[model samples]
Target: MKILVAGATGKTGIRLVKRLAAGGHTPVALVRKSSDTSSLPDQTQLRVGDLADLPAGVCDGCDVVIFAAGSGGDTGADMTDKIDRDGAMALIDQAAESGVARFVMLSSVGADDPDSKSDLAHYLQAKHDADEYLKASGLTYAIVRPVSLTDDDGTGDVILGRDVDPHAKAARGDVARVLADAVSSDDWGGKTRLMQTA
Candidate 1:
């Protein structure tokens, strides 16, 4: 399988790419011209394109599309909407049109509802909107909403369900493994799971 990863250069995304490669699947890293690709594996495939301005055929020949991109904390809310909401929706649309087999979304835990009281309300709203869009896009999809992310090594064990602890934290490597599993297996299809390290 050839999987297209939208945030392949980021912490968790990089881990996902490596996981896919080790599993004997081709991972296509979607990156902008300005992105630093030094962290990616030497033989990893690259597709130059920006989420803010996606190019045509970005999803072509891809079996699955994983949206792991984020606008980052340094940027303002506007950029969050641009990349997380609008950008993700655009990619979902393209993936659906391109006959991609599945779309696995990397969403946050609070995205089920954007709380005005939370500092991350806007960001959560963006993810909520994107998640909704993917659900309605007529594509086989998996939405993994993980709690706070950490840099710890993966334990290969996770707690997944709707009632997971809200304050729990997930290791980036574990999240990457779950996303990779979703791409290679049907067990995660049409499911929306909240994840945390067990």
Candidate 2:
């Protein structure tokens, strides 16, 4: 299967691309013109496109689309909306139109209720809107809402559910494995799970 990864240059996304390649699946990195592709594996395919303004046929010939993009903590709310919400929604629309099999989202723990008080409320709200849009888009989807992410190595063990500890942290490598598994297997279809390091 050809899996299109929207954030293929990020910490987690890069790991996912590697995992998919190891699993014998083609990993298509959806990148921008200025993205650094040096770290990607040799066999990883590239598709130049921006989530902010996706071109037609960006998702063409892909079996699965995984959205792992983010606006980062340094950016303002406007940038957050542009990437987290609008950009994700646009990709979801494109994936559906292109007949992609499933859409996997890497969301935050607070996205279920974005109105909750927090410094990241605005960002969560953006994620929440995009999540809701994916759910109602009539496409097969899987939403993995991980807790705080860390740079630690993957343990290959995780705790997943709707009621995970909010204070727990998730390793970026572990999250990447989960996302890769979601696309390579059939178990995660139509389900949303909150995950943390076990």
Candidate 3:
């Protein structure tokens, strides 16, 4: 399957690309003109475009899409709305329009219930909105929502549910592995999962 990755330069996104390729699937890295490709795998297929306005046929002929893009904490809510929410929605729309079969989202843990005590409420709200949109978009979908991300090496073991501990944390590598699986299989489709290290 041709998997189009939106956040190809991100920590998990890079890993997802590698994971997909290693699993014998073609991964298309959607990158911008100024994106840093230093960490990307060699000879990666590139689709140059911004999330704000993707080019025509950006998702054409692709089998599935994984939206792992986000605006960092340094940015404001507006950027989050654009990248996390609007940009993700754009991909969902384009994927469906272009005949893509499945859509998977790399969402946050608390998107189902944003933590009011943290500064991530807006971001989570955006994720929740996008997740809801995908659920209603009539596309085979899965929302891989992972809790606070860590730099620890993956254990490939995780707890998945909405009732998980709020403080649960997951390694980006593990999350990437799950995302790769979610894209390639439908065992967890029609479900929005919250994942964390077991």
Over 4 Å off, model 2: none
lDDT of 2 by residue, 15-88 (tens): 98999999999989999999999999999999999888889999999999999999988999999999999999
Find the candidate with the highest lDDT and give its number: 1
**What would the per-residue lDDT of candidate 1 be over residues 1-198, giving only the tens digit for each residue?**
999999999999999999998888889999999999998877689999999999998999999999999999889999999999999999999999899999999999999988989999999999999999999999999999999999987799999996689899999999999999999577899999999998
- In the range 101-153, model 3's lDDT, one tens digit per residue, is 88999998778877778678899899989999999999999889888999776
In order, candidate lDDTs are 0.94, 0.93, 0.87
Clashing pairs in 2: none
Judged by TM-score relative to the true structure, which candidate is superior, 2 or 3? Answer: 2
Q: Compared to the true structure, candidate 3 yields what TM-score?
A: 0.94
TM-score of 2: 0.97
The TM-scores, one per candidate, come to: 0.98, 0.97, 0.94
Candidate 2: minimum summed lDDT over ten consecutive residues — where?
180-189
Q: Model 1, residue 19: displacement in angstroms?
A: 0.4
Q: How many residue pairs clash in each candidate?
A: 0, 0, 0
Q: Among all windows of ten consecutive residues in candidate 3, which has the lowest summed lDDT?
A: 158-167
